[model samples]
Target: MSLLLGVASLSACAQSPAPERANGGKGTTPATSADAPAVEAGTPDARALAAIRTINEEIKVDRIAAAPLPGFREVVVGGQVLYVSDDGRYLVQGTLYDVKDKKDLSQVGLSVVRRELLDTVPTKDRIIFAPPSPKYTVAVFTDVGCSYCRKLHQEIAEYNKQGIAVEYLAFPRMGVASEDFKKMEAVWCSQDRRKALTDAKNDRKVVAKQCKNPVRMQYEIGQRAGLTGTPMIITESGVQMPGYMPPEALRAALDKLAAEGEAGPGAAVAGGH
Candidate 1:
């Protein structure tokens, strides 16, 4: 039996691009039609071709393989995990649940990808709010004009107090060369990036300046990650949670995730964008 998992949308507080849906349920879904071949163990290059057919400038396909559950092939495209039938015709988008193991297997694959990609972002490109003894850290894709992003920044101290370090990655809602993008550049180029980020988030004036900044690179990264909203959170363990979260609630979620990481692997695969 194949199960269809439901994907929820964030409020106006956050939005995403045209990425496929993800399933998170107790039952595993079938990727292939009844007439198609069953899934077999394989690599991304082999399995990815089966589904996407061709990889070009667009339709980024990361990897593909037999899912943890039988009968389904796992495909990662546009930074999201989707499943395809062995024939590559049938496609399923949702978090895959391995009921036998009582685990969310889809998250396991995504978290791995997020961690690897996030590691590529340099510290010089980010504005960090860190605590001396941080229990956990979250990287946020933020826009100066985003209200939810502002709300999150307003509680920066509270989050720091909870041992949750917040790293600000410039993700102007507007695409490059727009006013929002320029404003972000000003903040990054400021003498004190931390203060400039705070001021900008608070609607204070940002002295216009120019310098090589990662504002564009961060936006591109966000796009690849299917980031369509502000205040998008990526935990240290690579669990992505979208939209605004109050400090206490954020802390609890981070704490629970950190504890689960200690359990290792599948235990930390529940959260994704």
Candidate 2:
């Protein structure tokens, strides 16, 4: 579900409020003061950019472009989608629906964006389970101790045998401050990360060690990609299959995804942090 709600109002294009009357109720002048010169759309565009700049600087807006709907524009902030108005006078925090398409357009946009984002991440940064030769690769956001995560791990051989390569990205499940996050750090920092990850999932000891790693960054990526639970699977094209599936069933899903091409080229739009 989308997190943005309600319309935000701004004073950018609206006429100035009428001054309070001496009598104290309120007064109204002509809605459009005849003397007001035609609004300089060029200058207002600059003002609109400046208005968007006022959003929390740390939020990291990567791209902003006109939305499918008139009077609104789409902005990619922290890899999530949002809509703002043309004159920067209103903001809508929700997904846009295409009544004719019968699909969630926001999810469509995000899937393409997610695939592009992951394409930039090198394989060395993720733990990969693969067969000698593989036909498909899937990315999963996992927590070491999550029950379903363990179940998926135990069936890794089954997946690989089916020509499904599983690449793991960390998601601590608990916030970064928790022990699980520390453990995740240890696993990533280990000289043999693949072995360490397997051991941790098998209920064995993970050698406690620390070093610079992408564990935290991966978790943040998962958050931005709309992950709400462990074992969230993402296919090569960024189709999110949330939850666990038996090896055969998962292969079937992957085959189905392979048969269908991308959602659409128009879905691919995003900016980086």
Candidate 3:
């Protein structure tokens, strides 16, 4: 079960042609056929959970429920999901795809987790660029020094024009100890955050200053959210669109999600940059 023991605390730096859903979750839900055996409800027995804990004490078992596969339980650890046998002797760490429905069961659960975490962040902590009456809002994990992040910022106005509000959260692809992180801190500390961010993105020197800021907290949140790179976009419904998209394309994707309703997996856009 060591496979269930790890998680990299960490985007798409390159551009992907289409929108894609990041691996995520929706909580305990049945993923089997009508003829399948009835799934065991409630939490797994102590012995099973204990067996999993023995693999990694640092692994905090958040939730355990019946999985799509028989004799296995879906365990949510950190921001990722793992499928562990009811006996806890076997563990599987990968996406559970519903080939028939064309859905990612793993992402279904993680999406709820991601949405819960993202909701805790208040507007005061974000650098927002929005029209007076926006149609859609997206929170983006970004690094001031990242090229793709800069490209996204360059099109901020167009995104707003498309009725998309952009809220920026610092991720600084390099670890928090890097110079890029410092630049982000500077941007967050400036008197006019929007201008400071635009200036930094445009390669202009921002005044080096320090203050109590959300840059580090936001970066840590990004790490927990499974962000691998800068410019990772999270929709209002918790669907993630990795990489960069032009304003018009982004508006269209958001529109699709809106039309599909909450049950639709907005993540089907594009991936693999």
Cα-based lDDT for every prediction: 0.67, 0.64, 0.67
lDDT of 2 by residue, 240-260 (tens): 664777789888876665555
Least accurate 10 contiguous residues by lDDT in model 1: 26-35
Runs in model 3 with CA error above 4 Å?
A: 1-11, 14-42, 45-52, 60-63, 263-273
Residue 15, candidate 3: how far off, in angstroms? 15
Clashing pairs in 1: 22-94, 22-95, 23-94, 23-95, 31-85, 32-85
Position 5, candidate 1: lDDT: 28
Instruction: For candidate 3, write residues 17-133 as lDDT tens digits.
Output: 221222222111111111122334343544456666778765545455677778887776654678888776877888788788676777655565556567667799899999999
C-alpha RMSD of each candidate structure in angstroms: 8.8, 14.8, 8.8
TM-score, every prediction: 0.78, 0.72, 0.78
